[model samples]
Structure formats: C-alpha cells, structure tokens
Target: MAESKTNAMRLLDKSQIPYETLNYDHEDGQIHGTAVAEKIGRPQESVFKTLVAHQSGQISQICVFVIPVAEELDLKKAAKAAGAKKIEMLPVKDLLKWTGYIRGGCSPVGMKKLYPTFIDASAEGLKIIAVSAGRIGTQMELNPQQLAEQVKAVFFPLTKEA
Candidate 1:
C-alpha cells in the first residue's frame, strides 16, 4: 500500500470510524474516482471525489469539496453554502501543499488543514459511499452520514445532475 493510503487507514482507525479498505491495480492516467468504483463493484455515483477550492480574492480561505464522481460541483452553490462571495478551484500545487495529497488522491479525512467540508446531498440516503483512501489504488467504504459527522461536514445540493 502507498504511504498516503496507509496514513488514511491509520486515521480512520484512530477515529473509530467503521470502514473497509479496498485495493486494485491502478491504471496510469485513468480517472481514479471512476476506476475505484469499477474496481469495487459499486456504481460510480456512490463514489466521491475530493476537490479543493478557494474563496475568491487575495488571501481567501481554502475549502474542500466531496461530491459524487458522476456529478459536477456547482461553484456558485458551494460558495453560497460556504458563505463566501466567490469560489475557484485551487491549483494542484497548492492543493498538494494544503491537503498533503496530490490530485486524484486527495481525501477529506486526513488533510493538512481542516477546511470546511461539504458533501453532496445525494450521498445522504446511501448506506455506504466510496472515497479515495489517499491513493489511486485504494478506497474506503463507510457510512456517508458518519463520514460527514467525522469531518464536521455540512451537506448541500452543490452537485449537478450526472
């Protein structure tokens, strides 16, 4: 397992959050989110992708968004939910520095900073959702609500129809 995945597993255990780890052979340049779902035999809609965004303006606060792989993040909705006037996707370099995970491997659980987290409303009814366990080849399956509670995340309708 990769260091990032190991770190994530350690965090989840320490948090006492019930989760199951999955692994697969990661393909180069493939979208990790969809790849994870396919490997786990779950629908892509139940797999979430972690994205980093920043409030617009100089020295704006950074935010992390977790939404289903099949849906698109509505920045306007996310900004409104976050109480920020505007929002923009953070560059990969900054995302790595802030989250300590590179693009395609960013997980909301064990970030360098505890940014405000938002989960797409669609995840509410699901018993378990898949999220990157800080690596391309691994994923974590856990209760969506519990996951949100663990991160103090706020749920919002920030996703567009898949």
Candidate 2:
C-alpha cells in the first residue's frame, strides 16, 4: 500500500523545497515525539515537535514554535520571541481548531495559517531535522534553513536548558 501525501508534503512540493519523507508505525500508540524519533531511527534532537501558543489574554494572537522533542519550550523566551508579554500553550482541545492539526500530527510547514513561527536556535546548527508531515506515522526531514525559509520562521532560543 502506498502512503498518501499530506498537506505539509504537498505544500513542500509546490514550493520546490526538497524534503524526504520518513514513515513509522503508529499502531503501537506511542506517538509522542521522543517515541516517534526512536521508531523512525533518528536522534531525538533531530526530530522536532510543533507547538502552538497564544499571547496571554489574546487568543487571536497565536504563534507556532518548533523545538527539539526532548526539550521544553521556555515560555518566557517564547513570549519574548513572539513579542507577547506572556505566552501560554493553546489548550489541547483547541489545537485542531487553531492550526488544522491534531496532537502528534501537527507540522509547522502547512498550518491553517502562517502565524509567526519560530524554530529553536539549536536547529540552526544541524544539517537536517525532521518534523511531522502533517500526519501521524509520517515525518519529513530537510535542512533547517530550508524549513525556516518555507515557513517564514525565524531561529531563536526558544527551548530551556537541562
């Protein structure tokens, strides 16, 4: 059976941005980023996760952040990067409503709208990084710069230290 193309994959193709699709088994129900990385045989640091947040007191002021799955987003830094005095993760129930993606399948590439996306600065040093392909069990790997360019995302120190 052939896998179908996701919105993220289609968008990447239309933009002529080179990317490679990596698929994994999701039936086990271990869809978290770290488990996904292990299933895909990639380092956790190379597999990033997409998170959606909104400026405090303003649901309309939404933004996206991409960070290594193993790391946590520094809310303060994320807020600063997004120019919000305070930032809060969008409620899990609202994720699909806001980004047209559900948990474990959200990709920064092709969201409902482009909303001030940012990638962790650490990704800038990596040759390649993987993000969800807008579908569960699938991922896309490409140069960090190319991804940033495609999504108009800036690189920033959005993650917290261990």
Candidate 3:
C-alpha cells in the first residue's frame, strides 16, 4: 500500500506533528490491548488504548479516555474528567456507532466528533507513546504532550487503584 493514511494521521500531518506508524498482524479474536503493544515492540507503559466512555449511559455525552494498555480505567475519575456524576465503558457493540472506529482501532485523535478526552497523568513523563492509528494492524507513535494538545485532553488519574 502507498502509505496507509487515516484521519488521525492526516490531522497530525496537517498540524505538522511528527509521528511514526507501526504496522502489526491483527488476528480475529478477543482484542488484547497488551498484545498490540507487544506486537509493536513497545513497552506496555508507552502504549495506550483509546476507550470511549459514556456518562450515565448517554452516548450524547460520550467521552474518550486514553489510558495505558495494562490498566483499567477508573470510572470515578473518568466521570470527574467528563464533568459527569457517573460514567461507564461504552459497550463493545456500540464502539463503531459512536466513535466511528472499531474496538481495536479507535484512536483518540479523530472521532466523529471531538468529545472530551483525557489522558492518564502517568503518561506525562513518557517522552512518547503509541496509540491506535484509527485502523486495525496499525499504530502511531508521538509525544503525549502533542497528542494532548491536539485533543485538548486533561491529564488526570485515570486508572483504578490496585
């Protein structure tokens, strides 16, 4: 293919943001976030997944939470970030309908609409991170701060306490 382009990548390019795309072999089965990191040969801490959350089960108030692959999103913190009293993971079945991307390929960069986005505060220290490239079998690596700036995301505690 002559350079796989995605809306996320296009937006990054338009803004002159630098990023590197990594392609992997995606299998049909349970979507494992950690596996994507392994497949891309990156540490789990530097790879995040774009997960969509709903406020009180309302899609109209849907928000995106980008967190490390190995952590579970703290719903309470997510609700706080989205300015909602409650939040829950958007059902896997509704991933495409709401985010315009499938379970394994949702990037925080380019959604159908720019919903409120949040990144785990832990990510601030990392110089760079890998996130879904808005397509299966692909990922993009870039600075977390750049991603945050592009998405206008809040950095906060987003993972459940162990």
Local distance difference test scores for all models:
0.83, 0.94, 0.91
Give the candidate order by descending TM-score.
2, 3, 1
User: All candidates: CA RMSD in angstroms?
Assistant: 2.1, 0.8, 1.3
Q: For residue 81, give model 2's deviation from the true position in Å.
A: 0.6
Off by over 4 Å in 2: none
Total backbone clashes of model 2? 0
Top-scoring candidate (lDDT): 2
TM per prediction? 0.91, 0.98, 0.95
Going through the candidates in order, what is the number of backbone clashes in each?
0, 0, 0
For candidate 3, write residues 1-162 as lDDT tens digits. 587699999999999999999988886553578988888899999999888988995767888999999999999989888889999889999888888898888999989889899999989999999999999888999999999999999899999998
| Shift of residue 157 alpha carbon in model 3, Å | 0.6
What RMSD value applies to candidate 2?
Answer: 0.8
